[model samples]
Target: MTDDRTQDAPVEDQHPQPIDDKVAGILVQEEADLAGHDQAEILEALRQRFADAGIAISEDELLEQSVRIAGADGGDFSDR
Candidate 1:
């Protein structure tokens, strides 16, 4: 037996909705770009977009991840 109220609950108040096909496609493209590009280039583009959107991210964290990604690509972000 199922309760109708449970089914009517908003997603944020319960489980998140599954990502639709269009969103999945976008995610795939973004991931491919991340993998195929330089880490600093990718990170810089992300920072610029967020800055233009009036959102800010911590430079320390971004540098940390950038270094990790760069190391994986035979490059280094430490000197940056």
Candidate 2:
């Protein structure tokens, strides 16, 4: 029997890193900064950041991740 998994699989196929203390702190800061911003603005900002970081992400995917992060931070998005 031989292993079938390829060693050169795309990074996207790997599971994302688990959120730790450092990530938690970053999330808190991001949540604070995003407070009072509308969803469209937030999504735009995040998309720009991702592009600057050389990451390719669709607007919808970025928005989904942003909402997930906000929810994890116990944020109230109703205001914006």
Candidate 3:
């Protein structure tokens, strides 16, 4: 007998670009909404959100990504 799981796998595994694009779109859309929020609160919220999505990311990683995203948007987070 042959394994059948491969036939039931999601197409996303074969085409992950769209999924990545969608995630980026979501982050961009939420960027404005995140402004003025406490940095720690935002980090915790992001950590929880990613955890809920079954993704694991450290606080430092989240902070680094947050700074990078802010910089890309012409914002300064050095004071944080």
How does each model score on TM-score? 0.38, 0.42, 0.46
> 1-80, model 2: which lDDT tens digit per residue?
99898868658346555435333444355556775556666666676665654556566766775775445434552322
lDDT per residue (tens digit) for residues 1-80 in model 3: 97766646557556556545644544554455565566666666666667664555567768865654544443432222
Off by over 4 Å in 3: 1-19, 22-26, 67-80
Pairs clashing within candidate 2: none
lDDT of 1 at 67: 50
Question: Which residue pairs collide in model 1, if any?
Answer: none
Q: Scored by CA lDDT, what does every candidate get?
A: 0.49, 0.56, 0.56
- Residue pairs with backbone atoms closer than 3 Å in model 3 (clashes): none
Model 3, residue 74: C-alpha shift (Å):
12
Worst 10 residues of 3 by lDDT: 71-80
> lDDT per residue, candidate 1, 27-74, as tens digits?
234344454467777668556644653445578755654455444433
